[model samples]
Every structure is written in C-alpha cells, then in structure tokens.
Target: MSTPDRTANAPPLDQPAFARLPRDTGGPVFAEPWQAQAFAMAVRLSAAGWFTWQEWAQALGEQLRLAAARGEPDDGSHYYEHWLAALEQLVLAKGLSNREMLRERKEQWAEAYRLTPHGQPVELSAAMHGDHAHARVLGN
Candidate 1:
C-alpha cells in the first residue's frame, strides 16, 4: 500500500494537549525514557512502511476506547500503555513479529533486568540465554 502523507494524521502542534507532551529541542516529549522509546519505535516502524499513520492512529484509538470500556482511568496516565498495545497489535497483524517470538524476547529482557544490579543498565548476556534456540537471537 502507498504510504499516507506524513502530516495528515499528526495532531496539530498548537493544541494544548499536544504541547503538553514533554519535549526537548525537537519532536514530541515523553514522561519517561521508556515512553520516549515506545514513541520512537512506532515512528520508526511507520517510516519503515510496516503500517500507515492512519492505521496506527486507529489502532491506538481502539486500544484507548477498550481501556475506557474496561474502566481504566482515562486521565492520560495510561497513554503509553495504549500506544504499546497498538504497536504490538499492528506488529502482529503485519506479520513483522509473532507472539511467541515477542514473548521469548520479553522473557529474556526480564531475566536480564532481574540479574542486573540496581544502578547498572541491564544487558542481555550469554548466561541469560538458557537454550540454543535463543543463542543466536540473543547474540544479536
């Protein structure tokens, strides 16, 4: 499918809510490092042609609506959770990543995080790769 215009689905920059997103010298602001990473990942995946901006918006909107239906407080604290759900859904739908692979990777990350010292950044190590199947995947 042809890529949609980049500017079409973007929230207006002048809007107060849009402005409230934490910002640096450029781009949208995020409350935390992971939030920024999630935002960047979505932008990168979209630019890589995995999905269109409109599709991403729809997925995110749907996720938010579902959360609201489930009685999630819609006070914007869970915005990134919806973003992550949308990204995961789009990724799985597009066949870019499977649930099993994502689950395995998540386990690896969790293991790595658990083993790391509090002040140090977590890094996946060979010791964390319990089996041969993940050896190559973890190596990268």
Candidate 2:
C-alpha cells in the first residue's frame, strides 16, 4: 500500500528541532515526553540491528492504514499510539520480546507511575521487585 502523504503539515526546515519530521505532518509533533521516548526507543532499537528502516516503515504504515480503516480520527494527535503499536508488533515478530514480557514490563511501569506522587518522575526501584533480582533490568 502507498504510504499516506503527511508532508503538507510538517514543521519547516527553519525549525531545526522539527525539521526531521515529514513535511506533511501537522505542526507541534510529540504531545508528551513518553511519545518522544517511544520514538527514540524505536530509532535506537533499529540502530541496534533489531530491525530495518524499511521494516519499521512498513509496520507503521500498516498501523496507520488499519487505524484509518477503523474510522478513527486522523488528526495526527494519536500518531504515537500507532508508532508504539508498530514497535510492539515488530519486537514480537522479530522474537526480540514476547507479549507476556511486554505486558509484565508495562505493568511494572504502570505500578511505578501509580505509586509515584504527582509531579515526580516515576522510577522503578529494587523494592518494587520485592528483591534486587530485577535491578539489572532497571539499569538497562
């Protein structure tokens, strides 16, 4: 399938930070820190040889196409949700991680986020594991 053209709304070259985004995407990309984090993680993983840029593009394109088919709003605000979904799919397909591992890690982060007081950063601690066994994973 042809990728949707998103260059019409991208931030211009004069805006250094946003210049890398496709020119058709809406201005003011990344609504939250986690969105940027997820984007960066995908890039980092790809750089680390987990997947190819073409594969990543195909996965994200498929996600966008599916969302569009579902009658979801394509206002671009939820683009990162599709990005994260694609990342999860790629990781699973590559056998880099499984659904259960992802779920458990998500639960750990959720618990950390929940226990964290508002306005404070969520951190995974040794205590969260009830032992230091998972401390190495946290270090990663």
Candidate 3:
C-alpha cells in the first residue's frame, strides 16, 4: 500500500488567509490525513451555514497568531495543530459541541489509534470493546 494523496482533500485557496497554507504545485499539502480532514470539515461546515468564510478565516488567522506569540517556530510543522485548535474553538463558540464531549471523542479516537494494528484503519469501536478502554485507564 502507499500513502494516500492528502493534497486531494485540501481546501480551496479562496480565502486570502489560505495563502499561509503549505502548498505545492498540486495545491495545498497536508502533513497528515487528519489535517486534510480537518481542513475539509471547516470548509463543509462553512458551506452548511454554520459560519461564514470570513469568520473561519479570522479564527484561523487568530490561531496562527496565538501560536506564534507562544513561541512556536514558524516552520509550518504544526499548522494542522493550530487548524484543529481553531476549529475546536469555533465549534465551541457556535454551540456545536461542548468541551467534555470533545474530550471524550478525542480519547475515543486516541484509544482506537493506539489499539489498531499498523497499516489498518483505526475504528472507534475498537477502543470500547471488552477491556481495552478499561485497561488503558488503569495504565495496564
């Protein structure tokens, strides 16, 4: 198997703020599949009337500025981290999901990722079956 082309999922560079995205000739480049997923989520959400493109741009720009202020190197290595943070913040502000729910879902994904065999797509159900989640909580 080969790595998927994450760039194919990249958001269109319509927003001027998107100029900050790391890109290649094929368009925006994502370091990971989840990064592309997050990008697409924001685009879809905005398109669905959850927010306007301008609001998304402002939130993303503010996230990048906050990261820079916290002394993150401007090497583009953590762009998706900031992207996810901005998305979470916006989602909270929009009342789409609360912090506790987000935390639980994140834990679910983390556990699934941990238990998954290499090269297999992780499944959330894998995190909850039998004693997998319980054992991880007990640090076993």
lDDT of 3 by residue, 12-88 (tens): 44334424656456655876799999999999999999999999989998998887668666567788898899999
- Per residue, candidate 1 scores C-alpha lDDT tens digits across 1-140 of 89877887775343234235543465456778988888999999999998999999999989987886686656677789899999999999999999998999787787677667898878877325554546544555
- Candidate 3 Cα misplacement greater than 4 A, ranges: 1-28, 117-120, 130-140
Residue pairs clashing in model 2 are 6-24, 6-25, 7-23, 7-24, 8-24, 9-24, 9-25, 10-23
TM-score of 2: 0.67
Superior candidate under lDDT, 2 versus 3: 3
Rank ordering of all candidates by TM-score, starting from the highest: 1, 3, 2
Pairs with backbone N, CA or C atoms under 3 Å apart (clashes), candidate 1: 22-29
Residue 123 CA displacement from its true place in model 3, Å: 1.0
* lDDT of the candidates, in the order given: 0.79, 0.79, 0.81
Model 3 scores worst on lDDT over the 10 consecutive residues at 12-21
Top model number, lDDT:
3
RMSD in order of candidates? 8.1, 10.0, 11.1
